[model samples]
Target: MGTTTEAENKPAESARRQKTRERLMDAAFEVFSEVGIHAATVEMITERADFTRGAFYSNFDTKEELFLALAERGYNERLELLRASVANIDVIMPTLLEQNPGSLTATELGPIVASFLEQQGDNRLWFLFQSELRLLAMRDPEVGKLFLQQKHAADQEFGNIIAAAFTAVGITPAIESVELAIVLMNTYEASLQEAIMAGGEKVQERAHELFMQRMLGLISQLAS
Candidate 1:
């Protein structure tokens, strides 16, 4: 078979190509986690992926391209988790209030706040990614633009939820809710990166607890 025909006839070719790409992406993720975004390279990624240089090039044009792709994938995935999570928001609140009110400022707001912090832990990888993107924002306009677009979308989504919560309570929602959500999203994304640098996961729990108490306490105060 000719080159095109040969590539087409192999039943496993499609799967192989996809599998190879995933390997590279996974490799890049590991390398970035270790040496960070600026230091990670195609060679390091390919080494971890156990693929040839040619294979890596075939799949991704450059390390930056791969990083950007991985970052986008991470963001989309976390968004799905957050969107799905709030579906159970009502039920989760009561469970949180019942189980761990002492950990928060008040029992009534524990669930939503705790749940968000938990999801924040789950989304730590993407959170690391935003840290890199922020550093590159002014230096690299394209990456900055993509990063900002995602951030704005997340902020708006959180703002919408806050607004709905206020409307439900028969109060005109404050503008600060939108601003707070934006700050909350940005701060959390940046904060996780700091926590990642401070030894390990132990710090994460502590940070989450403090953030939950503070932010949720503020929210409860506003709602009241």
Candidate 2:
């Protein structure tokens, strides 16, 4: 009876622990998003999650650790979204086909990718979070090393998605898949940064569409 009770309690305990961790991470994401990693405090995260400082410490040793965890979570979430969206090629195909009839050129497909990229969430929040991480990585050696490792993993996953997307449409990627992925990603980021810096809400509203157009032109040149 004692053994059975202990066994039954173990799974329940584990689930509770997982729930707490997720709650903490979710709160941290909001706090970090609003105030940034440097400005965010454990207390703020705990208060947002309605947990205690002890709870935060139980799951994460340091603010930096939590920040890294948040970054990893973002990367994983994005990969999941990409895989799910890729699985349903129809989601992308309609737009690509409508853009320019006949066969799906790389140019047409590029905009479809831009559309999926926008589906992740609020562009301003994402851009701010990413910019913060990049700046922090550049300033700190240890963080920089960790960031590079994380970026490489993310790049590989994105490259796989790009390869799958091209293969699905029956067109081989014109360049090395990873290189092409890098180019597309860089273009998207740079365009977003420029839009955020220069324009108002109107720019934010149409930023994704503008990016798609720019990417279509660039990808067409690159792929051809």
Candidate 3:
């Protein structure tokens, strides 16, 4: 009876732990986005999360650890969004292909691509958090190693998505799919930084559209 009771309680304990970790991550994301990693404190994260410092410590060793967790969470979240968007496109693949026979041009599919990218979390706060991490990775060796690992994973996942999308449309990328994926991502990030520096959310929004325009031109040139 004792063993059975403990077994029954284990799932509930696991659920509680999962919820606590999620709350901490959400709070860390907000705090890091608002104040940045360098300035953020564990206390700030716990306070925002409505949990005790003990609760924070139970789940994470340090602010940097939580930030890394948030990065992984962000990556997973964006990938899910991308996957869902691609699934929707997949539903219309036959129609899309029929409409654009022969090699696909960016002009032909630019809106679809732009729409997919635009849906990828336009939160300014998240963007700020990402920008801060990128700078940290550039300057800090420890952080840079982790950041590069995360980037490589994201690039591979995103490259697979792009490869599937283009293959569905019967168009092969002029370059290797993963390389194309990295180039597109790097270009988008550069444009986003320019937008972030230029002004407010409005500029950032316009920047995505402008990025799509330029990306379309580039893809047109690259894709036959």
Candidate 4:
């Protein structure tokens, strides 16, 4: 029988470590969402992930670290979605222009923007987790600093996507891309919160509609 070489084992070991880290993050997301970060404990996360305490410690030094990691993951996921949405605009705009053959108005742009910005996964859970992070940042300076850094990076990336989308549609933004990204994100979050509060069978649908309407108006007012 051949013995396993360290070189061969290295890839397997790395894969295992990555899998562990992903599981822990997934579990932490749920726990943190259900109970605020302050209330969430390592044991709770471990139990949710069905891992030992040692596993959690091996993956993360502290809950705050895991929280930041989760935030980063969420931001990356959203950015990917935004990128995909922007890419679709390249395909969409030509057909739209062929049909209309003139400058596209807010009415024409609203659905595209809304489709890209539409909430994915569980909105209420995501909103709760996001709200918890914001509150924690307000109270904890260290976490706030880290959170802001991550948020700024995400905003910049999203801003690039926005810029790309504007270019695709031959529209010049009146304001900076980052500022526009921030405004649009804030508006989406506010609309989501309201929809969640409204409490109904179609909260996500309503949220999308509300955001699309607000976005159309903002686009009209903000774009030249």
Writing each residue's lDDT as its tens digit, candidate 4 over 1-224 gives 99999999999999999999999999999999988898999999999999999999998999989998898898788778777767676565567757754467756766655556663567777788989999989999998987798789878877787777766666777889899789888888889889988989897888888888788779876566
Question: Which candidate, 1 or 4, has the higher lDDT?
Answer: 4
Candidate achieving the largest lDDT? 4
Residues 57-156, model 2: lDDT tens digits: 9999998898888888888888788778777766667656455444677766775667666777776667778788898899999989988887887777
TM-score of each: 0.77, 0.84, 0.84, 0.87
Q: Which stretches of candidate 4 lie over 4 Å from their true place?
A: 92-97, 119-123
Question: Over 4 Å off in model 1, which ranges?
Answer: 1-11, 94-107, 120-122, 161-173, 187-194, 221-224
Question: What TM-score should be assigned to candidate 1?
Answer: 0.77
Report residue 23 deviation for candidate 4 (angstroms).
Answer: 0.8
Q: After superposition, how far is residue 115 of candidate 4 from its true place, in Å?
A: 1.6
TM-score of decoy 2: 0.84
Task: Return the top candidate by TM-score.
Answer: 4
Instruction: State the local distance difference test value for candidate 1.
Output: 0.65
lDDT-better candidate, 1 vs 2: 2
Clashes of 2: 0
Ranking by lDDT: 4, 2, 3, 1
Per-residue accuracy of model 1 over 20-98 as CA lDDT, tens digit each: 8888887787787667788877778888888889999998888888888887877676666666556555554565445
**Candidate 1 displacement at residue 60 in angstroms:** 0.8
Worst 10 residues of 3 by lDDT: 109-118
